[model samples]
Target: MTTAPADATVRVRYFAGARAAAGIPEETIRLAAGATVRDLVAELGSRHGDGLTRVLTACSFLLDGISVRDHGITLVDGSGVDVLPPFAGG
Candidate 1:
């Protein structure tokens, strides 16, 4: 197994369904320095349980205000990440 890097902090904002599932609007997460979005998702899943984990699978993320299309993208210290679950519209 690979070793995780040093810890780094990121601001995670949950919107709509994600917010409901996480039970919080936003939070700060401490993860490995080179952790990817995938890593963060897993961390969240392990913390929040099935409800949030389910929501997370369908959520999209914005890293520092830019859409994150790749889960492999590494996160840096003080970066901001938004978790947006699918929105129902008319």
Candidate 2:
């Protein structure tokens, strides 16, 4: 039988400037169960320091391929989040 996990495992993808600032294209973050997006974001900011925190401020997020408009949304185990910074073009 399958058992529930004690923590939520989030797969995070960073794009463009966000990726550059984070120095990694993607990563797996383990957060406490019932933790919200806000909590995850806060943890990231604290983990990566000021440069990433700045980039995160201007970036938009997609949770499991859907845009996340609410930071309070709770994260479940195996959630995938994308951090997309502004892209420059014509």
What C-alpha lDDT, on a 0 to 100 scale, does residue 24 get in candidate 2?
92
- Candidate 1 per-residue lDDT, tens place, 1-90, comes to 987666779999999999999999999999977899999999999989999999999999999999999999999888899999988988
For all predictions, the C-alpha RMSD in Å is: 3.8, 2.5
> Residue by residue across 1-90, what tens digits does model 2's lDDT show?
987657999999999998988889999999998898889888889988899999999888999999999999999999999999878899
Best model number under lDDT: 1
Model 2: runs farther than 4 Å from truth? Answer: 1-5
Q: How far is candidate 2 from the true structure (C-alpha RMSD, Å)?
A: 2.5
Off by over 4 Å in 1: 1-6
* Model 1, backbone clash pairs (residues 3+ apart or across chains), number: 0
lDDT, candidate 2, at 85: 89
Give the count of colliding residue pairs in each prediction: 0, 0
